[model samples]
Target: MQLFTGLALGSVFVLLAVGLSLIFGLLTVVNFAHGAFYMLGAYAGVFFIGYLGNFWLTLAVVPFAVGAVGLGVERWLVRPLYGRGIDYPLMLTFGLAYILVEVVRILFGAEGMPFDAPDALMGAVNIGVGYFPAYRLFVIAATAVLVIAIWLFLEKTSYGLVIRAGARDSEIVRVLGIDISQVWLLVFGLGTAVAGLAGVLSAPMRSVFPDMGTTVLVEAFVVTVVGGMGSLAGAVVAGLLVGIVVSMTSLFAPAMAEVSMFALMALVLLVRPQGLFGKKGLMG
Candidate 1:
């Protein structure tokens, strides 16, 4: 059960980490505001679930809404910072994160909100060891499907090819007549949309609060570092590894569960330095 729970938790981390990886890979921007986008998604799910009266619809709508906001932020705020030093965008996103959190607090108050799973996903299922929440199993399965789809999209589509090429050399892509700027906007939006998706998926599992993003943001960073800064495969593998370590550690030592990920990260850095899947010279 603990292992299963860890995998489920890791799936959430994979969603957030992959989005972060995508943006960093394409734009070379460290978007601290990704977590804020996630928090907003959770809150949006609450509003949409009530308004639309369907969990599935909430899942579909909230990401697009948040992604649209991400597009504006990229167009006006992030796009302007391009060609400046990396620190400028990093600081901008950090400040944006704070601003988003404060705005949400003002609107929703400091209290944590409750989000419940739909009736269809409220129960548990037997799986050899014991019964586990059906929703968690759904999360695992859904994350796998989404990850596979993302992989296919990145591997098979023209846009995916552009994104891959852009990551390698945007100058050459531009010389080939591709509008790198528009791609940046789309990638940023897509990354934030992924974060929003993770947020809605996570809402029912935890309290929806302004500060909730802080912890997840930290974990996502750890995952990014451990997995490789811009490697989607690394993010997926490291997310599950970190999730399992944290979950299993809680069984024996609750105090150490939180620290286990950091410990593992330090170990990985000491050995690999560039991360398990991170390529040399890509450390930015």
Candidate 2:
């Protein structure tokens, strides 16, 4: 059951961490505010369900909303920073994160709010000899489905092929006479959409606080680093690994739970700095 629970939480990490990785992978953008975008998606879901009363609709609407936001941010905020020093994007995103968090805090208090499980997902199921929250199972299944879909998009679709080509060599992609800039915007939106989906999926598992993403950002970053900064598959494996490690360790030494992630990052960095599945010198 604990392992199941860990996997459940881990799925959220994978959903979000991969988005962080992909955007960074393609556009070389460090989007410190990506977690804030996740937080915004939860708030969007909270308000959306109020009007729509449809879990499925909220799931669909929230991602689109955040994706639109990402597009806007890229167009207005990040676009200017392009071709500049990396610090330009880093500083811009860091400021954006602070601004978003402050705005959320102003609108909602510091206390956490509850987000109910959808009626269809509000029960427990017996998995073998143990009982698991049906909502948790749903989370796991849904995350897996979304991941595979995105993977397929990245691997199969023409758009994905171009994005991959751009990732391999932006200069060559540019020489190919395709506007890789448009592809960059699309990938950024897709990455942001993933973060938004993670928020809605995580709403049932954790409190829907305005600042809820703050803590998650740290854990998600750990997953991103451990999985390799820009490697989607690495993030997935590292997410599950971190979840299981945290869960099992929490049973005996609670304080070490979060520490375990840092420990893993340190060990991985010492051994394979580029991360599993990551090309060498990627962080360069």
Q: Model 2 Cα RMSD, Å?
A: 1.3
Over the stretch 70-139, how does candidate 1's per-residue lDDT look in tens digits?
9999999999999887789999999999999999999889999989998999999999999999999998
Model 1: how far is 175 from its true place, Å? 1.4
Note the Cα lDDT for every prediction shown: 0.92, 0.88
Off by over 4 Å in 1: none
Residue 241 lDDT (model 2):
85
TM-score, cand. 1 vs. native: 0.98
* Candidate No. with top TM-score: 1
Candidate 1 colliding pairs, count: 0
* Model 1 CA RMSD to the hidden true structure, in angstroms: 0.9
Report the Cα lDDT for residue 139, model 1: 88
Candidate 2 lDDT for residue 135: 94
Residue range 1-284, candidate 2, lDDT tens digits: 88998898889889889899989988888888888999988888888888899988999999999899999899889988888977899899888988988887788666777788899888899999698999999989988998899899999998899999998898998998999889989989989988988998898788698778888888888999889888889989999888888888798899898898899889998998888767887756
Q: How much lDDT does candidate 1 score?
A: 0.92
**TM-scores vs. true structure, each candidate:** 0.98, 0.96
